[model samples]
Target: MSDSTSDFLAADAHAQRRYAPLTRVIFRLLLAGLSGFLLCVPWLSASLYWVGWFAWVPLLFALRDTRPWAALLLGWVAGTLCSAGGSYWLAEFMVNLKQVRPLLSTLLALLFWCYLGLVIGLGCLLYRWWVRRLGGWDLLAFPVAMVSVMALYPMLFKTHFADGQVDFLPALQAIDLTGAPGLDAVMMLFSVLIYRLLTPRRSPAAAYSRLAQGTAWALLALWLGYGYINLYEWDRRMQQWDTRRVGLVQPNDAITLGIPEPATGFTRESPPEMLATERLVAAGAQWVAWPEARYKGYFDDYSVRDSYARAITRHGVPLIFHDVERRWVDAQRISFNTVALLDEQGELAAQYRKMLRMPFGEYLPEPWSWPLLKGLTDLVFGEFLRPLGAGSEHIAFDLNGMRVVPKVCYEAAFPGFVAEAIHTDGAGKMLLFLSQDNWFGETSQPFHHGNMSILRGVENRVPMAHLINNGPSLVTAPNGRRLASSEAFNRAELLADVPFSEQAGGSFYSRHPQLFLNLIYGLAGMLILLAGWRGRSRVRRRGRRCSRKTRPTGN
Candidate 1:
């Protein structure tokens, strides 16, 4: 061959080699992204389930061959997509509220995505790091490290996956003995194991085949075991107080009542709510639940309370009204959402102010950010607000022979909070959830909220009655079985006979929460540090040996 031609060919070969690695990296990233998007579908479902968590296995496997930073970036992308897709409900709420510009809302959406993706990527990175140190140990340690961090990271950020719905009950139950942190560890570890098994570099065909077969069997066993256990629990614990007719008055009132955008504002003077309650009571509702913030006007007044009392006193039926407490701040007063329980005589029985106030839309932690926050709050026309102080106590009231516990609004998401309410009141019977979901009418908010109640029901082994102002009013059996649900955006009442039982067999998690999940991760974290130290020592010893071997002392 001519010299020029030979040189051309050689240059071409070098160029191809240089770009090949980048091409492969891109391919792997694309694969990971596709896998992540698909997996996120379930997590972002109307119910916000984690059914697709299994897809992480394929993505993690694809990431293993890449550089550490590349793995992190890819994981981040996947995580972002997942979070954005899963939590698009909040983004949609922002859009409806018209608070922030669409561009800013999109940016915020992506920011949440990135944050969650970072957790996913960090999990992959931790798995890789542990794999590098202990080699084969990545099968267990890597998953443990990644899941532990991912699970805890959400808690630290105050947006834990525990609050999400769809299969969380099963997921939590699967990890009940281990706790969520440990369950996270187990999930990640299993993914890594699958990844390692699938990768040709890590395993031979026969071993891969064997491992795959074993995995299928193990998974099948788990499914059957879970199905049986769920059934067993249902039969044993799913009893409720017999035939106590509940009158759930779903007054589909505008959520932005006092805020803005011309809601059909109602006060105690609004006869419709009173009429509806009377209708529900006449239809055999012994206890009537009004929607969240059911009052026509600001309800922090005695006269309003007296009027409400008189109305219900005439019916001789207990009424639960979700009211708001608004105090003027600057030109506008901030409003707090609250649920007030009343006796048949209309006397205030118990009240709970909402906790877990919405972020960005609610009060900013810093006073300086009020203007920025107000700009955002203007979407819903709500006054940028301050959080109501946590309720001093949980209300456990005895109606007839049943002891019932009530949770207000989003308080159902926090298991500890709900448990505290149930146990502290010394009244562990049935569960009552009073919420106002009129803000995001017919959106995924109500469904997502309903899913949280499912988890609460299963976790506490208590039958729950979910009463909402607008949307998805339903009752769940102790085993997380849905009995009946009211439609969204309907002005109506529902009647369900909830049976109450005194049997209190605490689940595994109820007995020892932090110990099963948190402590194990703490120990695993310590172990990773220990493994890293050992790895460093080994590297140093090898370096010293190499240096001596190549020394010029003999020459």
Candidate 2:
């Protein structure tokens, strides 16, 4: 061949190689963005249930070849987009409110996105290391690893509720006893399996043939399993309590944080407390439940006491209203994450304070603690540091001969807290969930938050009487069927004839909390350790060879 011909071909090859780097970078960025979009899609108000699983595919691709810095940048952008889009409902409500400066509220939303990005980015890095050592058959690791990161990611945030699973009913049902962390793990594992099925194989024809066969079998197995399990557990639990008529009060008032609380969704001068109570009584509710912080301000004191007394005289049924904590001199500044219980006469019966606090959104536990200098924390994290002291003990109230265990706001998402509360009350207890779903607005937050109760209902084998400040006030039977629920994003109430059942004697979680968490941590730790050890050994071996080569000084 001529020299000119060889030179021309070599130049062309070099040029092609140069574009490879840029092409790879562009591909990673696009994949990252797409993954972000898919994650947010499942959170839309009208999203189909199956759409949530689409997120795992692009995420798995991101895990495979994404660069470290790209992992951060891409994850940050995606996290922000997903979080903002999914929970944009919060901003819609906040935009019209006068209490918080609009600019600050918007800033808070961005802050949430950035915070979640950091956690996910960390997960990506961890996965990169873990996957390098996984066995050939470890296809399941893709989903399991991603989900584990998602589940535990909330713990790093100031609020555990941030980890709450949204809209994944089957996943949440698994959480009733498995808890949020476990459910997250299971979802991620399944996601990897589904992604694998959808991915095209090296040979398209072979891949299609295998996938077709596997898919049919998988569908058949899932159908029979779901049906059999549902049927088997159906009649196992029998309701023991006498039926009670419960009225849920939904006042459509948009609450302005710093102002005097209003009763209806719109502005009204008189307190809606007494009026709402009278309406519920007139409606013939054996029991009435008000959403979280319905009255607001100074609830545990004398003025509030007199107010309830007057309301009770007019209403014959028992009342459950959320009380705002009175901030007084050194009163520990313990604001009530409270659910107030009152008898037919308005006499104070019992109360349950919220157990789980939203991270960064709720309180900043240790702001000064830093792992590495570059690891950034959220600014809004410490802003609302209203860490109400944890509720000291569990309390139950008896109403119309029924024992009721109460949970306030985010407490329903924490399986451990619910199980403990149920155990305190023993069998045949009705679980009453009082929540301010308004904080989450019309996003998946409220729906996901509300659905969590269904799992608790099934796990404890007790009926749930749920009252939300906004929408999705739901009633779930002991078997986890939704008996009644509010139309989304509206102020409404439901009267449900709940059939109570004895608390199930054994729960998978109750018998094994430490075992599960430890096993997960242990596995994660081992993977991390193995990766670190391999990296260190390589460094040491290289160092030894270099040392031997430079040993001329010993001669």
Candidate 3:
């Protein structure tokens, strides 16, 4: 070969070496993106639940042998993409309901998506650090790190890796024992097992991978067996429990913008909600409920309050409805998102003030509340962001000798919060969730919200009547079974036979709310300490070898 030809070949090899890292990075990013897309599939539609089982496989491959920071970046990429896909309706909700500009709404949505991504990124960072410190025990390190981040990191919207199993009733039965985080652990453990099994034979983890794989399979089998048994037992108990006829009203009303003013009296002779209530009563509903903001006027107005009472009096049944309560505090008018109950005599029986305030909707938090950004916030949100006062106590009402716990809009999203409320309220026999989901229109937001609320009932083992405006309202049994439902953007009245068991206390999860999470925290802390100690011992061994090699020796 000529010298010129040899030079050309050398240049070609140099170019490949120079661009190899870039090519590899691009490929890894694509894999992460694919994983993100898969992660969102089950959330988009329940029928695609199978996709969630293997969704994280590509992301695991991408993190293999990667540096700590690089692993975080890849995890963030996957998480952000997944959040963006799953919650694409957020931008539209902001623009249409909050009256925000399209560009600003898109930017805000992107910021939230990135914020949620931090949880996954931090998990990956921990996993990489643990792997480096404790050798190649991917099975233990991956699940612990991921579960810890998921359970510890706080996000505006709480989503679990196990949410994909929402439609899988048998798998969901375990949540009653350990809450959703346990399912998250199960999902992660199984994913890591699959990752190890598929690893190449020459890889370091391949030798003991079979042992780990066998153990994982055995655990999974036991878990599924427990799920089946619990599901059957819950079904049997529900069948034997007494049933109460409840009416759920879905008004399908358009979300009115701006803060509403106190009305002098009922404006219309017969509002659609009142008419729906009357129909439900005629259909043999013993109790009735209206969705949040269904009564647009302030209940503090005596005329408006009387009008609701008179309607309930005519129906001859107890009624629960959502309204805004205004009171004078410090000589200033304050508003509360409240759920009011009217007895059979058309008199006020009990009321529950909403405890959990939605971050941007009911109140502003942190940087948004800064005085300097007040003008900008006002321009984007206008009067939509009402700084409502939060309630301090968990309140429950009586209906036909049974305790009914009420939860307002955003309050239903939190697992621990809901469990605590039920536990504190004397282990309520029934749950009533009132919400206005019209802001999200006909998007998947309403469906996702309703599904999550249904899970709360299962966790606590109580019947639930989830009433929503512009829903997908649901009446769920204690076992997470849907007894009745209403379509979105439709005027409908559902008469459901809600079943309730006469148990002395709530489910184990509701009774011991923090036990599972605390256990996870302790386990994660121990593993981190163990990793640090092992890392120090390795360093000491290396130092000893170096010192022995350099020591002077006599012949």
The models' CA-based lDDT, in order, is 0.63, 0.60, 0.81
Identify the candidate with maximal lDDT: 3
> Per-residue lDDT tens digits of candidate 3, residues 33-134?
888899888888876777887888899999988988999999999999999998999999898768888898999899989888878888989999888887
> TM-score of predicted model 1?
0.82
The digit string of per-residue lDDT tens for model 1 on 1-555 reads 999999999999999999998887787878778767765565446353444445666576567656567777777777777666656665655555545566776776676667777887786677666656654455455556665666567531323444343344455454334333444454444555556556665355224345644664476458437745874566565443355777777767665523432234545554466778888788888887776643555365576667777788888988766666675656865666666667767777766666666544444455535786556545533444344433456666566656667777777666656655554223246778877776554766687677677666666566788887787799876666667788877766788876555544235555555555566577577768877897999999999999999988853
Number of residue pairs clashing in candidate 1, backbone atoms closer than 3 angstroms, sequence gap of 3 or more or interchain: 18
Ordered by TM-score, highest first, the candidates read: 3, 1, 2
Q: Write the per-residue lDDT of candidate 2 for residues 65-174, one digit (tens) a residue.
A: 45445555666666566666656665554443323566877876577567776666666666665555432223434434454566577643222221333333344444
Q: Point out where model 3 deviates above 4 Å.
A: 1-8, 203-206, 209-211, 259-269, 367-376, 379-384, 424-428
Clashes of 2: 9
Q: Please report how far candidate 3 places residue 315 from its true position, in Å.
A: 2.3
Residue 310, candidate 2: C-alpha displacement in angstroms: 5.0
Better of 1 and 3 by TM-score: 3
